[model samples]
Target: MSAAIPPADESLYAPLQAAAWRLGHLGQSLDGFIGTAGGRADAINGPENLDHLHRLRALADAVVVGAGTVVADDPRLTVRRVAGDNPVRVVVDPRGALLPDHRVFQDGAAPTLQASLEPGPAPGRAERLVVARRDGALALDDLFAQLAARGLRRIFVEGGGQTVSRCLAAGLLDRLQLCLAPLLLGGGRRGLAVPEAASMAEALRAPCRTYAMGADVLFDFDLSV
Candidate 1:
């Protein structure tokens, strides 16, 4: 049976219209795991959450994901479930591990950009975007600047945990949307892996609002404040 589609909440996504906005999203189980230890996460979220992700992609000027996500999910990163144009697809592959066969590289459904640490020919129809590395990680500032240079100011970081964690830790994301499913996985990949804080005072406490997406609950955090 097809899952119920939730109604769109305009107020929930009003912050995305801000100038130079950046939003990150992740859907995980109630127990705080995005996938199983063996890398199985085909159905972590319901159809309503998937529709929400497609809506974000449709609104974004560019949708970004880490190489790990592409390798695991092989997502096309297009706005198929909603009525909007597709955004530019970006993949962060600092190590240049992805091949030419990945769907995002060859789909040709939307313009694709491969952000890497070294300059090289892009695979398939994608373009190469050489980025700098800071502390052995892709420099988020440089990536954002490069994207902005191409008029991609409204960014969406749709991820596999590590990439979203990096943006959150760097304070680059203006907002974050975390959807929690009702299922519980005892042990698996974490949804968010930000750096550990030594004390409760060091923890991040942003103002947030919650919405019901069918059986899943979405927590929309306003981080720009």
Candidate 2:
């Protein structure tokens, strides 16, 4: 049986009202793939789910994405689908893979912060935030502390799998919202690439709630619980 769709409003994001929180979101197919083999992931979810993403951006003090997402999508990361101020845009590019011409760096729609381990000139008007490397990856805890020092407490980790997965594994995400679309890509990129569990007993579990968003089903997991 199909689940009842909830009303589209601010109430849908009420859980984010906590004083300090980090939220990670991913939209994947029914088969647990976020994109196809060719790296096409545009519009995987329905319009309502897209609006939900924008709502998340609206509520957050900063919206973060990995360099891979910027290289692939070049999103502006603005709050256009809903009525709210655009949050500060943050790009995690530890390898310096992205060029300065990306939309997020060039658009100037909102303040942009490029977090990286390398020291270089920031593209366009984006500011450079030097981060440390731990175990060959950017230290997410250092990044979070820096962000908090900058008065960005409400964080939204909107991503292309690797970034979200790293945050999830590091115990940085307070909540995770996984939206599942009806379509299934037989073979493609997987979502939430966390470390393999030895058995079902070792699998990560959390208290969750469900909401229907148009044709997609949103799974809201409270990992902090």
Candidate 3:
């Protein structure tokens, strides 16, 4: 995903909406978060992030989530406001629980590709890819290589926490974007993973960048190059 910097990096212009999305999500919310405590909208789902996220949809080659994410979020995964073409949609539905009846499979824009370990093809027009794996999840290396072959640069790995944390723990993440909302969930759920690590440095280390958007702060993780 490396490239020469465009002159408009510091500001967003009308034509470069997609570019803006990629740069903006450089440090986005942790997992999924949105809105403030006192707001009418409440939940882990943050509607505030949607505007810029549209830009990200245009820039990414694919928007990926684990099946758990798809079932929980059921995101349309489209670029509603951005200028560029929509990215491909991918779901790591290892066991194929994300049925065709889901709205996601119904979207025809970029098309939804399910990367699973299931034996047969999924019904309907939804594409099925059998990824090699021991457990239900696809092998990370195989998944990325296939994506690369399809020219899916700057793939966005959205998540259900476990998948995102897996990418982090295996050092497969190129960048990490986290959004911090002002209010605390306290007992609901954490935004990132707390996998057992050998050391504190290992736990916290990544290439770093930061920025602000509305009431949220974003963190860009730079994994070792």
Say which prediction, candidate 1 or candidate 3, comes out ahead on TM-score.
1
Ranking by lDDT: 1, 2, 3
Against the true structure, candidate 2 reaches a TM-score of 0.93
What TM-score quantifies how close candidate 3 is to the native fold? 0.77
Error of 1 at 81 (Å): 0.7
In model 2, what lDDT does residue 87 have?
A: 90
Task: Estimate, for each residue in 19-80, the C-alpha lDDT of model 1 and write its tens digit.
Answer: 57999999999889988876856699889888889888877899999998888888999888
TM-score of each: 0.94, 0.93, 0.77
Per-residue lDDT tens digits for candidate 3, residues 11-102, read: 43232334212222322234443222232222442454545566556667788777766666567777765466777888888777677876
What is the RMSD, in Å, between candidate 1 and the native fold over all Cα?
A: 3.5
Measured on C-alpha atoms, candidate 1 has an lDDT of 0.88
Q: Pick the candidate with the highest lDDT.
A: 1
Off by over 4 Å in 2: 1-11
